[model samples]
Target: MSAASLPGVRLWTGRVLEDLRAGRSCLCLLPRTPAGGADAAAVLDELLHELGDFVLLPAPGPADAAAPRGAGLPGPPAAAAPPPGGPWTDTAPVLDYDDGLSAFGVGPRGGGPVPSDAASAAGRDTPAAHGPAGGGEPGPSAAGRAPERGRPTAHDLADRVLKELGAAAPGADSGPAAGVDGLLHRLTDGSGAASRVVVVRGWHEPVPAAAAELLRRLAAAVKAAGLPPERRPRLLVLAGPSGLAAELPEQVARDDVAVHWWWGVHGRLDTATVVAMARPPAAGRAARHQLLEAVAQATVVEVCGPFLDLAERLAAEWDGSPDTLPPQLRRLLCDEGLLPGVPDPDDAARTVPAPRGPAPGAALPAPAGALREHWDRGLADRWDGRLRHWPGAAARRDPRTQETGAPVWDWEWEHGVRTRIWLAQNTALLPLLDEAREAFTEVIRSRSRLPLPDLAARYGPRRDGVPGPRPGTAAAPGSAAALAGMELGDMWRAHIQGDARLSQPEADRLRTLWRSRNSLSHREALDSPRLEGLADHLTR
Candidate 1:
């Protein structure tokens, strides 16, 4: 296919430019036997036209070419290429247009290379136009004198690009859509850091606990990196099979801790997804729309992955200066229609301290149901009252300023949200309490099944219609007393004899579990008849 016949040339070129400047190599694998105008040919043609210095050449047949095409050049139109004897010398950008090209090799480009282990990997969605030169490993050949990021293999470029694209940073790599095993690393290790893992895992798994563990790892990593996690919410790239979509947030919440996370994930990468993601809008929190708008922006071409990466790098990127201002200014705070420190936004701010608005005489639009409620919170100081907070973190209006305020120095970042979600995803409660209770019940069959709490966050009482933290869950002020009051031993004995129809020996084991659970929750051990029953049950 000739350059005139290709489509998507613009996007292809943009990706190429992005890779080239990022110091990544690339290739376009073309098919020699015209498979009758495939999409790849059109893309190749577009790339050829966009690329001035590149030239077309016949791929080297098993036998030598009469004149040898793709290579053997001062490297295409000298007018546009890098000039003589400078930092950019040996490095002139060249696009080899290969006719009879079964594949086009971008040459370790920051592009997708064909799979080296295609057999084991199964489906190859987009096959590379060309395998690397010499076809040794993958990407570009290593005949060059200097060794680069790797040993200058044909794959270094693609590997690097995938490394960035396919990274699984803690919170970043995790999601409901991604499976634990679905994340496959195509590149070698010791590449650049993932910044954060962005797995696309979701809650479709029956065992929610597995998903929680993944989130737990992410929080751990953020703390270790010393990033202002409270301020900067990192991106989590998530792509999962359809219908299983809603499972992402639900699974994370099983552990309860995931409810407070500051992580964000991508659910759309195409226009269709963009439209589908945005709908008539749900009647939930107004801030949810803000979250939706951000994801929707990422779905269309309006945003690019590398640009997002760059933005995040800038947001979280520090010169290691102690004077580093909060990334929140970049991530959230906007001044006069611009985020702080942004050149264009800063320039606009210099001219006007506030954002442009409706004409002076025009009335502002009235807010809606949920929106009105949220606005009212910041406005007249009323609570719709769905939110629960760490005692001190709850907001209060300043008496003088009349603005919504939090008495605490720091309000909870979304980290707590993610934590709550994490607990839900794990189908878990606190280790010492729920875990021991469940283990004891299963271990002691003779006892009545006292029906432990239903892996839900709120099990015990309702504080003002909302479920408060129950006995085994992460309790607040009165947690310890609540568990003791349940009278688990007597309750279990009755349950076993009456409900489970168990004898005294079986009831004894469950009695032990009740005591052990209480002891563990208080960070102690038990040695009495009840605890000994549990010990005996475990041994048996």
Candidate 2:
């Protein structure tokens, strides 16, 4: 499919064009796209191929990459991984000027007036939907500058760029030629044709302290320089969450610099649109609906390839039949077989027989081909078939059996809960830990004999202003706890108490621990050793 057709690409293109038209610098905050989905690199490639009159710059290494870390916000953590290079290099510059915006010219720093009326007239006449044309040939060679001498700093690049634009003499040090200020002055001075833009790629990686400082200086210069509207070259900063607002001193300061965030597929692209693109036309409405929901719930990385593969298999297996598959692939793997229904303490229904598979019409296609890779990763971590599952995957596996199909229904509630908690330890923050616990609670809820709605009500939120009952207090008829107000802590305790595998003392500790979750705040640093101990207690 053409890049322009994808929803993600369209959203990206719109933003870039908006920035160019306004003659303002852009600071586009990029998110990591799933493995098979649209990404910033793809968008940039499309722009280079079609858009004219822009210069692309590589990231100044980690040293020059830093921006202000927001107050009390976490420092730039490491990026998950570096992006792979394809047809384009993040450092290369692509210049094209088919649009009127390209007619911008720059005067020298401290130079007076728009250089010429011709440049201004051309910019005013440029059309917004200027069709794709090759970036016109470089006058002074945009490529091959500062190569053998090593990549230049932002300051040096800005200086070199001005020299290329003919705004300054080759060795001129107008006001010491310090930063991007010189380049900005030239672009605004009317020395070039139309307003120019410099796209700074690869800010997706963590920004180091020095680079942060360089950006601060540049921002200050931009603010103070007072370049006219026509000469102001847009500087687009493309980065991930950590790198998002790092160019600014605080979150509020982000307003002055355009900050666009990527909120995964749900926000950046339409769910129905993504589904339509991934599945065949014959795929049923129900399958498409399920795929949309699954994509939302799936742990996003990039547009996940495994997910697309699974969707294809599901559609092919159904083949226009009326068979309805389970909406979620992850849920299907863990909940459908081995474990059966969750054992309810007050009721005699403990181990319901596992159906040979999912209920007849709702069965999911087997995890084969692309699906198996994710499934295998979801299963044994050690891969020796000893059933070593990650925290997220552990909750779904049958705690009672070995990987080779040996029966060992000696699974204890504490052990299962402990494995889930193990997953929690890997997370960097508290809210995520709470999410992992909630997933475990939901897994058990799905297997209960009680209707899904009733279980949900019993476990739903407490009424506004109604305080939680003291941990051990008896429920009053009209009190919040009595009106189906049992929180996750309560539901978890009840489940733990009914399992004989956990002694009363262990159960009490576990319940107390569950309630303790409320004490942790989102911003609070996790005490790993302390949480790990709780996991140990569960196993013991």
Candidate 3:
């Protein structure tokens, strides 16, 4: 699509052109996505053709994975010959503007002759030698000229631009300050052409300290460049996802700095826009509206193709059949097949399956309901009792430390509280455990006031005045051997089976985890691995 056709693209280009006309500098944040970046570059290309003597700097380090691959230039290269030195000659500073404009074969505003490619014309200074004397357009084919070797990194681009400005090195012993000063002078001083434009991308990458410093300095330098307003240069800095924008001073809040943000495909293409995109531009409203809901449901704009394909398949499959399929089931199919980043059929087949059945040679395992109920009630009672009767549970008073001596908390008490809080905050308990615990509690609570479902089930419901289970016969599930009167380790072993389950080595691991968990809850010791192990067991 043409740049003007996209709302964001139009806004971006319009503001940039407005800034150039006003002799102001702007910072534009291109989206990190492929489409957004491409549109941003297209806006720049339009700017280049409209206003010459500009420099394009690539981002430092490896190109982002989302960036477009295998490029010539981000936009179409120059196709026509450039004019000889003309109107801006008087305004040209140290090196004439024509000399720099030739680099990209761009020309001045209002449709002037475009310069020859400076890379090719680098060896040959004047256009007369390469083109007709009367200024007829250069006839040499683009293939005749040498092409750029590969994508240039940010540092490399910075060095080239500095060299172009006649300030490659600030002076051997003068240091980075001098180099920065020299480059700034080239941009702002009466040495470079008025209204020069420069684009520096990828400042967020691991660029050299010196290069990074130069970019940061530009934030402050922009105001200075526009001091006189008439001679200001237009600077556009494009940052990526590294959050480099946060590292540098913000421009969005600054009155002198104009900031534009591109928030990727979702930001620009909404539900209605996407539906329109699915059909030919000239299609009728009825045709467009027919697929509007389906297109709107697509999770990602790039998935429009797959979504349309899925719709087509569904229609063909049910052509002569009854249309009795539930909408929810069709939605599930769309979610699975048309959502961005959703695994394909091949991927789903390759994925490791969840545990589905009891291990071989084991009796049909007892329903999770009984075991879950026992664990929930038993663990909660143990945790409550442990908290109440924990060591240092009673505060000890130190007369010297407390004037009133009402109840001075000792270091032991303080340590206990702190350690308990830390463990509670940092433990990596699995969500599934909490879910199971809650389900079990709700089931038992709904049945009666008794905590353990097994006890209630076994005793055949409480009589109006009957006491709870006899203390001697009952044991909390926290006890290593109380679960179904089977060893906790053995119960775990019997519950899980197959190659996917942990081996015998893990039984000892389970014992250690159990011991450590108890100690942690009792505030006896602090161990991160114990918490991690518990998490692992629950998740597995």
Candidate 4:
């Protein structure tokens, strides 16, 4: 795919579009297609979406237009729109010049501008989409404005974006999915300090200028709201559609966007990761946000893979993403949402404790594949996983160490970017954790029961915002007394565990303690010690 000059790519755009027709603001990835010659903007538009409701991307530079189009690549559609009041229309696939406007020849319904030229003369080889968040020109796209940036901008197109997402908007840093609303509200009202993000992943270039314009607005809004660069919202424009590599970095970047999980395909929400994703804080523990920005902006040069690993440590957070995430980290951060209150960027660096230095082979790519052998431990870690991208097999890594006697733990995907299990604890145990995750997913999916308020049924009038043993008390201590021993033991053990994922020594120690505390075992049923030992030996 990379070998092609103007490589047109296809990627799952996700189902966020449902939020659009429902009247909610959203961000989406519009398909990108290059046109022949250096005409830059859209000379002709393509009718997309079965209902003809979709948008288009900009034309590629002339050099790229010479590349081979996909075999059987559908030709462009007629310049057109849907029935006057009808929903979008189309059954056949369509490709056209992304001029950056709506089928209505306007900005998305009720928004301003993000700074895109109607002709989509937007800069960058790639452009992002703002959905309805870009408040300018109501979706006329770059023809009238810029793609909506997460923050406010000073440029003409970006100006429309600033008018919307100011300080007064409801600010959502992170939390419930509803937080997205707060972010949108804050973008439109307040100083725009609240961070939000829009992500675009596709290999096709000539990104619709509307996407860039939207980015400008977001940037402008951030400034209007006094958002320091560290807390600014982000719009991550990916290179292609199909591969999952973009998801991990997009999710874990120092500047992260919220992830919306939806049900897809037979019994498998977990079955597919629309975009490989996870998350991280905007600033590292030390609060060196500048360093983070440098990495995010792709400005740093890693001297070696370890240097990049060292950077991840020095920053106190992994704002700039590394290529490979140990499997053990698949869900390690389900609870650590970025806190709402912004911390002083400088203070983060000052207060952050020193790091433990880079992990061994930290800069090295995973055990197998040409990337491992061909990769140069040059002055900096280029993390080919980030710099180079492909589709399908190449993009979705199938790493396996080719070394004659490599340990199973050292096995690598033969086709994708490679990396060692960055974290020592993940060594030789990712498969087990993956299995557990799969099983746990199956268990929950087996039933369609509502997942919340299992105790709601026992609720009554609250003396204070809690349920009481008697009347008028929210969560009375007395009502919870029967479970006291269990609580105490759980607290004690959890405190000791400290999320190390436990080892045989720790389990053995626990077992000795359990045996010595027979009374504790009979009363508290401390059978966990043995189970812990079993788990450690079997998996770790």
Each model's lDDT: 0.29, 0.37, 0.36, 0.27
Residue pairs with backbone atoms closer than 3 Å in model 3 (clashes): 82-114, 82-115
Q: Any idea what lDDT model 1 has?
A: 0.29
Instruction: Summarize candidate 2's per-residue lDDT along 1-540 as a digit string, tens digits.
Output: 433355544654565566556555545443332222344455666665555666555433564336442211222335423233211112222122122222243321222222234433332132211111355321111211211112223444554445444455422332323234445445544556335565655443233222333344434444565655555555555554343223242331332244443322122133234444544444235544343333222212111122332323333333221112222333333443423332233331112221132232221112222222332222211111121222223223345554311224323433443232333233322444355454445444443445544444444344464444334546543343432444557566446544223446644554645644553432221233444444443333
> Which of the two, 2 or 4, has more TM-score?
2
Q: Each model's TM-score?
A: 0.17, 0.38, 0.34, 0.20
Cα deviation at 62, candidate 2, in Å, is: 22
Q: Candidate 4 — which residues are off by over 4 angstroms?
A: 1-15, 23-55, 58-203, 206-211, 214-540
**Cα lDDT of model 3 by residue, 45-71, tens digit:** 566676666666542335444456421
Query: Cα RMSD (Å) between model 3 and the true structure?
Result: 25.6
Candidate 1 residues 93-202, lDDT tens each?
22222132213221222332333433213212222212233655432221111212222221222222233454443123322111211221211122333322222112
Query: What's model 2's lDDT at 241?
Result: 39
- The parts of candidate 3 lying over 4 Å away from their true place are 2-4, 34-43, 59-159, 166-178, 203-212, 219-226, 243-253, 264-274, 280-540
RMSD score of candidate 4 (Å): 24.4
In what order do the candidates fall by TM-score, top score first?
Answer: 2, 3, 4, 1
